[model samples]
Target chain A: MGITRRSFLRRAAVVLAGVAAAGAGWSYLKGLAQSANEAPDQAASLPSAPVQQRTPQPHHWAFVVDTTKCIGCGKCVAACKEENNVPEDPHFNRTWVERYVIDEQGEAYVDSPDAGVHGFESWPVNSKYQNIQVVKSFFVSKLCNQCENPPCVQVCPVGATYKTEDGVILVNRSRCIGCRYCIQACPYGARFLDPNLRVADKCTWCYHRISKGMDPACVEVCPVGARMFGDPADPDSAVAKALRENRISVLKPNLGTRPQVFYIGLDQEVR
Target chain B: MQHLTRPVLLLLTVFLLLGAARWAIPRMFNQISFAIQDRTVPVGTLLGAGGHANVPQDIEAWKARQVQYAGPASCTQCHQESVAQWKVGDHAGVSCETCHGVASDHTANETPLPTETSSALCTLCHSTTLGRPSSFSQVKVHQHAGEATCASCHNPHNPGVQGLPTDLIRPKPSAPLVQHVVVAEANCTMCHGQGRLRPYPQDHAGWQSPGCLLCHETGPTPTLVGASATLGAPFAGLVQAPSVPHVTDGVPSCTRCHDSGAVRPFPQDHIGWSAGVCLLCHQAGPAPAVGGTAVGSPAAGGGGDAPRGVSISTISADGLPPLPHTVVGYTQCQDCHGSDQFRPFPSDHQGWEITECLLCHKSK
Candidate 1:
């Protein structure tokens, strides 16, 4: 019997379909087997369970310096020198007491480099003249402002400087290259190169003390109560409370370092 | 062309079947395998199968696992210095995820993988708008060009120590009198009397009352009695004198002989009596004498007798003629004549040629 064209075509199509179905069934089974074998390896390779997120606790610190209560005494200076081992040169680390005199003539003058062991008598007789007869005379103790956005840190090349979570700018002595870039970058001239360590240094805001739960030495030594320290993040912190109650200004606002050190009675000339 | 034969037809059919298998067999296998594997069957395969099971209901599942967040402390193990400096830094509280996004990949990979972060990561916490005050903002710090960064001068683990010791000891003053004077006053008032008189300590009671240091303490102060005497005889004599005279004369008292010139014959126009007058006497040195029969004397009518070329004018002879005198034709005799000839012209008596101008011209 002769086969028709249509019958032959039908037979060919049926054969092709059967082969395709068999091939697909085999491929699917192969994939499932591969996945099962790899599952345990992937699980074993996973890193240790993620560290538990600690619940944040209430930890705050702060400070306060009452300018009205200060009497321009150099007791704080002496204490700071004794505590911190400040150099004898006025250009170095110890805080300098500045007598800000505003005369009736509306002229303002500042006298510094006067506070020492002998006090004002220690000032050089040949030093430059500083006008004193002003409408008001207040003593301002000048030190590192300890800015939030420290320009010193921003300019450091070796990643030696950094701000703490608690809002303190600090330097690691071990890593510091002593390049002094921070000194020049600081708009307030708060940074000085440490001769002993050969590193750029500034106020740490006493991180050593703060971390261990203590007030800074300068704040403790201020006799007239011209210095204050605290955590700004805590509303109850002394610094935070003062910021809420009084008008405080940071040095060099234009530089935008966001100094953590706040001055209650900062004069225009102080910046 | 040959008569119809069954064997020939069968052979031809076999050849045709083999050719069809070459094209269709592999394609059919591919479609069946794709369908069983949960993939959509190709259109050709579906049409070839007469629409039998063309679509697959069990599509392969693609599972994406949940990502894990790693804190900054994890980075510290490898980056000890950076972490140490950061511990005391204002940015210490900032988290690792805050900058590097999810750090799961970095932690999981055995080999170092390329990170997606750049300087922009720093800006997240450092931007002026987003960061706390005192923190550097990318917008603000960029102005420093490339000089600014988080690690510039600070050690992330140990911020620089400020208000540290300077280790300087002030030197003791050389003069005992200066030390005594400094000790006597609460301020500069002891050496310098109150008000304007304080600045001229040499003016009799001015020295005994108060000195110039009461206000003008920073710069040069008029030598007080003790200080002047300690400085030497010249300064002491000048302090004792009423006013400091021209270089030709001995030094004069700053305020004594200088009272408003109304009482004295000298021109009231002396610039030294003006504010900052101490710069005159205490200047580096005395100026040369003007038209005197001294070292810089000018000749009469001689072309060379003009005043010396020095920019600063010296003290003029008080009683001398305005110039073109009978003895000297020119206002400045030193212009034309030598000191020797001019000395005799003025009646070289009292050893005028040898006498120093300062000795005679000294203010009384």
Candidate 2:
């Protein structure tokens, strides 16, 4: 009875399946145990510290772009370029100001010449606005929103791009494989491949400066105070006050990246 | 016993062979491997054990990227006087490296830094353009200077009028101030001569000062005073900037509290405003009723000066307490907590920095 070929085959199959199921279950249990171990260790240590020994609160760095205050001076772009060594080419910018001209008919015309390094003095050369009666015109400065849920971070093939504890998303140049998946994944069109470094580059909110407790160069040079960056944990920071006081909105909010860069007086046509 | 031993050995071999086949077969097939990886599994990545080594090395490499700007702090070491002068000057907010170019090399290698004295440099921010905030002091460069360099009349350091008549410093609403005093009154051509370097304008070639009042009477086209109301008080030493209006104790840094993200942040109009000039204008203690915006009035009422309304629960949302000791000077956690070292990590904690340590270790 035991020597039947079909029965022997069935028994062998059962043994193999049992071993495979055990292996899968063991790995799953290990993962659950690891995650569980992490929770209590964190929880137990926090409340034990005395009140006076508390470290500076972990910062939540935020950026505010006051479109109403932004005169589209392009000074920010100029400052950012000088600070970051961004390519001199107009097509590439870590930050740029686009002038949106909305007409009476509800059509919007947008252009950012030379990434506003030269400012928005020059309008569209062909001039679609000339034929149509323009209702209003405003400048919208665009930069990396440093989204809390960063698509660029998700798309990075290597673990090159990461969001810092302070909320700034950074790209590790050494680890970046020069794949433009991040550039394509960004809804805000914030990322650009660095032609010289041959790696993807975007605004870091000047990590070097911010880490050293200084404002980003763009915020440093903006004469009209259009761009502001600070940790929101401190109630007195400009970003906090602006966040609390201003009716702020993010670009392409429908996609829901939860951008840290809040814009005051953002136009409907702005994307 | 021998028959049973053979069957057990045979079962063990069969199980081992099946396990190896299951692991290797999917890895050999690209589509199966891709599905298992949930990504396009590169053969180089799969084969190379160096992938794990890349993580820390790449992180350190990214940290090693040279920060080109040495910042104003570096310049303060040698050029304290210039920094002091520039700090109080109208261009107080503009960092020294902004106009002088990146100073990292200058500080490191004593490289001769560039000094841009051209009007073009001045006009980058100061030139009248459509998008420039009307509050900012901008001028039509051609009309404003008229062939003369800005440094000719305005001091580059402080930028207010220099080397001019004393009364012209505080010009009346209707005073015709001469750019230069008349050297030879009767023979006006001696100073205002056609051969002179800064000759009279083509329109004012023949006309003189008394007759200058006929058209050019309104006082030098009036310095752009559109923002005069909000530009803070007139330059009367350090007290002229703005008053702090709140207790300045405990605050280790002005920007820490006054920055855009701070609770008592400065006005939006003060963009690019630097900390060097904070104490210059804003005297500590309560702000005067007349001068300066009442900055901390709302928070000032809270009695305790601790930054009010902070949601401390959200401070470190990851539930990892800060380290007991500051990691300021300590660069590596492994230096002290390595396998053989003092208070060795719980056999599990990996290498990390202050950025990582603060995720779990609550620091004082």
Best by DockQ: 2
All DockQ scores: 0.02, 0.07
* Per-residue C-alpha lDDT of model 1 across residues B261-325, encoded as one tens digit per residue: 23343434433233223222222122233444333322333333333212112333233332221
For lDDT, the strongest prediction is 2
Q: Write the per-residue lDDT of candidate 2 for residues B291-340, one digit (tens) a residue.
A: 22221222223334332112121222223333332222333444444423
**How would you class the docking of model 2?**
incorrect
- The clash numbers for all candidates, in the given order, read 113, 29
Question: Tens digit of lDDT per residue, candidate 1, span A106-193?
Answer: 7766665544222332225213323344356555666776676677877776556666555656665434556578878888776776
* DockQ of model 1 vs. true complex: 0.02
lDDT of 2 by residue, A1-271 (tens): 3455555667768987787667656654664586566556434322221211112567788899998877665778887888788888877899999878777889888877788787654435324455767677777888999998999998777666888777888886645556688999999999987756657899988875665566787887675678898877778788899999989899888888999899999889889
